[model samples]
Target: MSNTQQLKDLTTQVRRDILRMVHKVNSGHPGGSLGCAEFFVSLYSDILDRKEGFDMDGIGEDLFFLSNGHISPVYYSVLARSGYFPVKELSTFRLINSRLQGHPTTHDNLPGIRIASGSLGQGMSVALGAAQTKKLNNDSHLIYSLHGDGELQEGQNWEAIMYAAGNKVDNIISTIDLNGQQIDGSTDTVLPMGSIKGKFEAFGWTVVEINEGNDIDAILKGMAEAKSKTGKGKPVCVLLKTVMGNGVDFMMHTHAWHGKAPNDEQLANGLVQNPETLGDY
Candidate 1:
């Protein structure tokens, strides 16, 4: 199969893994996971450098951070599928003694994750720190981070943005899952972020908007454009417009499924939408 075909299959498999893992745990976030699967798949399968396995300092290679780590299901699935670990281990998600927890942490020394997250807004700071350190070391690889739209409410992210722009941390490409709905409800209803693109531009960051969050080809194009925007003395932010529950019909367009695991029936139905192109974990 072509690399593009492989990425499509990997993304479908990751979505299936997310559904099954979340269903088995009976408690985990799925909405955002489903929404970001394509972006993660495209990055891990096609864009990122994985010459070394889970290196903290991904020296001479690209790196990624999950700022919105509550979407651990998608991260874990992508990591496993990308050869960071055994895919079967996905079944241990959220179980006792499992390396996979409700949230991700580096304490477990998990093969793929480099930092602890899920406290919200802290990942951006962590990412900024990593980027700055890379600069100090004269590394050329770029750093990538993903954050939830709702998580922007945390003040720490803005501080990190300010720091990155002020210090000219230009090799970082961050993404916000602009899926509108959060666990509480619609993001606008919860706390409106008027003109997000304008806000980031005002903060001195280059911004790109991906109109189709679930389309892998579109995401790839947007990411390439986002990368080009980097290294011009500004951090790049991609406002990814995604559906809260992108693939599953019942779960879409609402915050009700944000943190709820599907029952067996729901899982069965959701799998039909994603299909098992690369086989479920």
Candidate 2:
């Protein structure tokens, strides 16, 4: 069993990692990365049935794909802390020739990253294909994927969504980081996506809503419920409502910080708000 306090502590630490990784490089996306800290921490720490080490062929264990790969800081941090690689490697984030890039890439052969994302709308297709492969091999383990709500603007997602449900890709759970704010502005201002839940249901999916995407308890329960809904002849979609830049008071509720790295003073302030719970890498 995973302890709530421990999960919370890990979240705080992951937030710290996101902030520091972005601040160090003076580049990379921090807003979405910060927003999804809780989900990433909970997924790695308590949700996915992971194996002992990393491999390209994940046969028996659950696999996770990040479609919105700009938020690579949180993903990299969680993978490292989960023992996929040395936590110290986080310092190389966005640095020249580093495995960690502005967006996740398989070119570096990063242990935890299975696919190169950030083009948007393509992750769903890749994940669906992987889920299908799992089924073919008779592996009962599930496949999990995360996408930015804004990425839905791409027409490819709808096609994938349609395909997943039409074929009954029941071994996958796809979660949307429904933080209303995207890069240019609020999703409504940039481009409003009407009723994600309704859309998924219309596409023939089992949908669940997590009202508090930042809360560890909510993520744990929501994910458990999502797991239960799988393999019932429909893919599961989780509408995770999150506040962009969740941990830092100054960064919350705005799209301005989406890809902007914090300055030294700003970084210090953010660090104060999320004091290190697990040691910084």
Best lDDT among the predictions, by candidate number: 2
Tell how far residue 40 is off in model 2, in angstroms: 0.3
* Overall lDDT per candidate, in order of appearance: 0.89, 0.95
Worst 10 residues of 1 by lDDT: 46-55
Error of 1 at 15 (Å): 1.1
Best by TM-score: 2
Please identify model 2 stretches exceeding 4 Å from their true place: none
Q: For candidate 2, report its TM-score.
A: 0.99
TM-score of each: 0.97, 0.99
Compose the digit string of candidate 1's lDDT tens values, residues 203-263: 9999999999888888989999999888999999999999988778998888998999999
On the 0 to 100 scale, the lDDT of residue 207 in model 2 is: 97
Please give, for residues 1-281, the per-residue lDDT of candidate 2 as tens digits. 68999999999999999999999989999999999999999999999999999899999999999999999999999999999989999999999999998899889899998999989999999999999999999999999999999999999999999999999999999999999987888889998888889999999999999999999999999999999999899999999999999999999999989999999999999999999988999
